[model samples]
Structure formats: C-alpha cells, structure tokens
Target: MRWNAEFMSPSGRVPFIKCGAFVVSELEPIVQFAANKGVTLCSRLSTEEKAEMRAYMSLITNVLVNAELYISWLDEETFNAVTKVRNSSVYPWPLGWLQTRAKRNAVAKRLKALNWHDKTLDQVLADVEQCCNSLSQRLGDRDYFFGTPTELDALVFGHVFTIITTRLPCRKLAETVKQNKSLVALAQRVDEQYFKRP
Candidate 1:
C-alpha cells in the first residue's frame, strides 16, 4: 500500500512498521519497541542526557513536523500544486478526491490544535528555522547530538534529508534548513556513514 499505508497503521499515519505479527506506529513508539528488543542506541546515555534527548525530540516533532504539515496542507500554493496531486495520485476519481480532502482537513485540524493553523507561511518557515537553530546549537561541533550516533541522529537526518531533497512549491523551507551549516553537515555525515553503506 503506497498511499494506503495509513489505512493499515493503527494511528493512521505513514512510516509505521510491522515486525512479525506486531505492528508499531510512530517513531518514538517504534524506537521504544526496538529498545525493548535489545536494539539499543542510547543505552550509554545518562538519565539526564536521555531526558534532554527526549526534549529535543519533542521539539522536533512539534516544530518540524507541524511545519511540514502546514506546508503540505495549509499552504494553498503547495496544497494545490503538489500535495493534493501526490496524495490522490494512487487512487481513482471520486475516492481520490474524497481521500485528499479528508487528509487535508485532518491535517488542518491537527495544526489548529497546535496553534499552527493560523500562522502564515512565513511564520511556519520561521518556526522551522528556529527549530534548525536549536538543533544546531545542541549539536555544536559534535558529529552527533551526543558525540555518538543515536536515535536523535537518525530522527534529525530523516527530517533534514526530506526537507532538503523534496521538491516543493515553496523553496523557503529547504532554503531555511540549508542556512544552518551545522545541521546540514550533520545530515551529510549521517548520509555518508549510514546510508552510503553497501
């Protein structure tokens, strides 16, 4: 299921994982599930460090994710030019139209709840830039958030990579991300070390 993956997800979101007979939705839950299975990344972190990581992760989820949703759904130009077409591409006619409308409405509601629905596109981009700035400060000169690869690195890489590479009607988001050299460097490092492996 390409566009239909959300239908199978317990939370009606994409990027859910199925391990054997069990299903895990969302990144944090999936990471916790993996940790429970002995696949640990932040095991060496101190309790305080772990708490800080969680806070940063929450910031990313609240800021970056909301910004992405706003761009894809709330921005009229992007919604009309990219999101609507891509979202409905896998379906035919009336169902596609129905699904796209529903998804857009759901995203709008979510953003509204987060107080992001009323923000202008410039405001959304500013939020993304501030998010990138915070992440960059945390990272500083370290190659990773904790001086070692962890779930935080993976999470940051996933969002930053998508923002940079994705074709969008508005280039401001990508441009904003690119303005942060440290974050871009971190993304490049992850891409080189992990994704480049054969």
Candidate 2:
C-alpha cells in the first residue's frame, strides 16, 4: 500500500495506524477497530451506548471544541496572550502568525456558518457550561463516561484537558471545567491513568 501523505497535518490527522501491517485511519474507524479486537475502547458499547457516544462526540466536536477554538484563536486577548505565546514558542514568527491566522479564520468561518459568530462570550460560556453539566450528569462521579474507561472518555478528556490547562487569557471557558469539580477530576483521572510519563 502506498501511503503517500503527511504522517500528520495541522488538521489533526494521523496518516495511518499500522497494527502489524493492518491499517486504519481516522478516529471512528479506530473505535470500530477496538470493537473488532474486543478491546476496552468499544468492547462494552451496547447499541444505545454506541449511539450515545456518537452523539456526544458530535456535540463535543461541534460545540465544545468549536468554543475552545473560538475563545483561543478569535478572542483578541486570548490570542495575543496565551495562544500566541504558546504557538510562537513552538512555531516561528510569520509562520506561527500566518498559521494561527489561517486556523482562526477557518474556525471563525465554521462558527459563522453555525450562527455562532453572533454569539456573545457569555453565550458561548453558557453553552460550555451546559455541555459540562450534561457530561457531569451522565458521568456522575464515575471513573469514566460509561463507568469504565473507553475511547469516549479519552476523546472528551483530550479536548477538556487541553482547553482547561492551556491557561487561556480569557479563562472563562477553562473555568467552566474547573468550576465543575467532576469535569476537572475526570481530566485529571484520565491524565493520571493514560498519560503517565514515569
């Protein structure tokens, strides 16, 4: 198989997954892969649970992640203070500025298409709070979304941790999770469980 593509891209892609010559690309298939392998990722997903996971992923992708992007790249204070500082640390000027502008524009256009452009920061924060509350209600002090660690937990934790810990200048969105002790604990738990560096 000719895999002639960037191994990764700014679009958040891993070119392929090679598991002993078998390959899957993209996230959903990776979920399917775990199900096929009887792995914990999707092993216990009932029909309803699968549906719920997909729905939550959709909301997270469109709403939670979008809000983070908006707050990070579009908000001037956040962009200049936190986003630019961190991005410029890893990416040189002009390139960093150019890429940040591009990504910010892309996210802005997407949010505009979703009619989120007109939304006030308070409105955005409200949406984030709603999302956190919903997840908390579903999670309810559990170790994971389904009461056990699964790919869904990993997926949500990835975004939440990044958003919360990045120290966004505005801090409203980050505070949404911190204000919710359960959400904060969930991200912390996922980190301790899966991302230990020792």
Candidate 3:
C-alpha cells in the first residue's frame, strides 16, 4: 500500500485530493468513483452493503463530525486548550496563531450557519451520545459495520478514534464513547488489523 498522503489544513471544509490533475473532493463521489473502478476501498461492497455504508457515513458526518467541530471551535475551553494548538501545530509561531484564529472564525461561521453555534456544550454532547448509541447498537457483536471490513468501518473509526484520542478539556463526547464498550474494542481491533504502522 505505497501511496502519497498530504495533511490538509483544518479549514472547515471536506477533504479532497487530485488524481493526475483531475480534482475530486466530496466523499460520496470519490467513493462512487472508487467503486466504479473496482478499487480496493469499495470492491467488496455489495449493493445492500453500499447502501448501509452510505447511511452510516451520513450519520457520522452529520452527527459526529459536526459535534466535533462544535466542540473544537464553539466550546471556549477546548478552543483555547486543545483545538488551538492541534490545528496550528504545523505552522510556525505567529503564522500558526493567525492560521488558528482564521480557522476558528471559519468554523464558527459554518457552525452558526448550521444553527449549531448557539447550542450549549451540553446540548451538543447530548447529540453525540445519541449518535454514538445508535452506531454502537448497529455495530453490536460484529467485527465491522456491514459484516466484513469495509469503508464504513474506516469512516466510523475516524470519529471514534479521534474523539478518544483528542486532548480536549471537555471530555463529554469521549466519555460517552467510553460508555460504549463495543466502540472502544472496535477501534482497537481496527487499529491492530488495518492501521498498524510498524
């Protein structure tokens, strides 16, 4: 699995990439393209499984991703302590500070547009709990979301692992994740099987 990977800055946008100068950005189209090309990421997904994967992806993106953004930007303590340093870790001092502030403002505006900026931390975390619970129930006793290992597992991993590992002063979301034992083990299992970097 030799590949080039770039760490795109956190700018309140979706991840995207260039394939031989043909740019593809959004997640759904990228996934469909891969599936159409019989790529490894989606080669094994059946029609039903693909639908399930898309459903889960929507849930995670809408619920977990937004909750993460709200916490990282709107929550005062997390912004000052964790998000600020993490989002700016790559750039040098003054530039890093400026970049972080710009990113914070962008995320704040996006959240406001989504009507999420005004919610209290508790409200946001309550949504996190519901989302996690729904996902956890869907994943009970299974190694992956839709049976065998697939892209859905990978997408789910991104959020659960991120919440667990993020160094936020506010840990409500992480705590909710911990309350679900299956998610913890699912992340650990996937890390061992798919993401080992030795």
Candidate 4:
C-alpha cells in the first residue's frame, strides 16, 4: 500500500527494488538485473527448459494478472469491499476517495486496452483455470517447475497463493486454484520453505 513509493517508482508500480544505487522495477527486469549481478536461480536449467519457463511465465502474466485486475478493480463487490479500502488507506478525507477512484479508472482503462475489461467474472475465472492447468501440467510431480525453484515458481506462488489466501467476496478464484492439486502443492512448498519458519 505504499502509495507514495509507487509514485516514486520509475515504472510507477509496486515491487520495485533498490540495490545500492541501482533501482529495478517489475519482475522480469528485477530478475535480469540480478542475473547481471551473478545471481541466478535458473543457471542449472537447459536452454529449452528456460524457454519453456519463459512461456509459462508469460501465460501467467497475460491470464492470471489480468484476471486479478478484473477481480480487484472491475468487480464491484471486491472494489467496494477490499481494494478501495486497502488502496486508499494511506490518505484521509476526500483525498482517499478521489485517489481510489482515479486508480480504479486507470486499471479499467488498462484492462480495456488489453481486451480484458469486457470479460464476465466467469470468463475471467476460466482464464485463471486454464493458466493453472498449464502450470500444473508443467510442474507434474516436481517440487518446482524445472526440478528447481525458478522465476516461474516464484511468479506462480505469488499469484496463486494470494488468490487462495486473500479474503475475496467471490471465492471462486481461490476455489479454482485449489482444484489443481499440483499447483496447490507447489504453493504449499514455496510457502513452507520461504515464508514459514520452523
């Protein structure tokens, strides 16, 4: 909810990181920046597997991210209940209301540009299902997507875990993720290893 930080970001978004004087925003650029600094998680993966990883990552971004925007901003129930409150929490008075409205409008326009604005809730859910299906199939019985934790795994965990855990008015999104056992297991593994302490 760092509203001012988001505005300060070069990309005008959250999830930006600063390493000393270098600042990187967005996931792919962050990953690339790390790689340039001799830090990489996919070093052991073969070239073809890396390509597949990128494909799956693209799928998650195109499908799951759009669905999230749809649910968070365009879904009236969720906007009125959750997003508005959380996004506007940093401000007071009419400023909070105005900022939230402007943010929602921007999201609506972006969704429309991406052709995701018109999808029904069910359609958006279906897109999420398909994305999860691809991820599950790729993961198979592996602990991660490529026998090791890659960026794809991190990306998947970020989105899937949030969907399942966040308190949404519509439970269908979480339910869809839970339906995929493999994906659920992946999320559980990531959560336990990275998020939970012994």
The candidate with the higher lDDT, 1 or 2, is: 1
Model 4 lDDT per residue over 70-156, tens place: 999999999889999988889988899999999899999999999999999999988889888878987889888888888999999
Q: Candidate 2's residue-wise lDDT over 162-189, tens digit each?
A: 8777755586787887777887889998
- The lDDT, on a scale of 0 to 1, for candidate 4 is 0.91
What residue runs in model 2 are displaced by over 4 Å at the alpha carbon?
Answer: 1-7, 10-26, 33-40, 88-93
For lDDT, the strongest prediction is: 1
Off by over 4 Å in 1: none
lDDT of 1 by residue, 1-198 (tens): 465788889998867999999999999999999999999899999999999999999999999999999989988899999999998899999888999999889898988898999998888888888899989999999999998998889999999999999999799999999999998899999999878967
Per-candidate TM-scores read: 0.96, 0.80, 0.83, 0.96
TM-score result, candidate 4: 0.96
Local accuracy of candidate 3 as per-residue lDDT tens digits, 20-95:
7556656666676676667766556778877877888898888888898998787888888887877677778898
- Judged by lDDT against the true structure, how good is candidate 3? 0.78
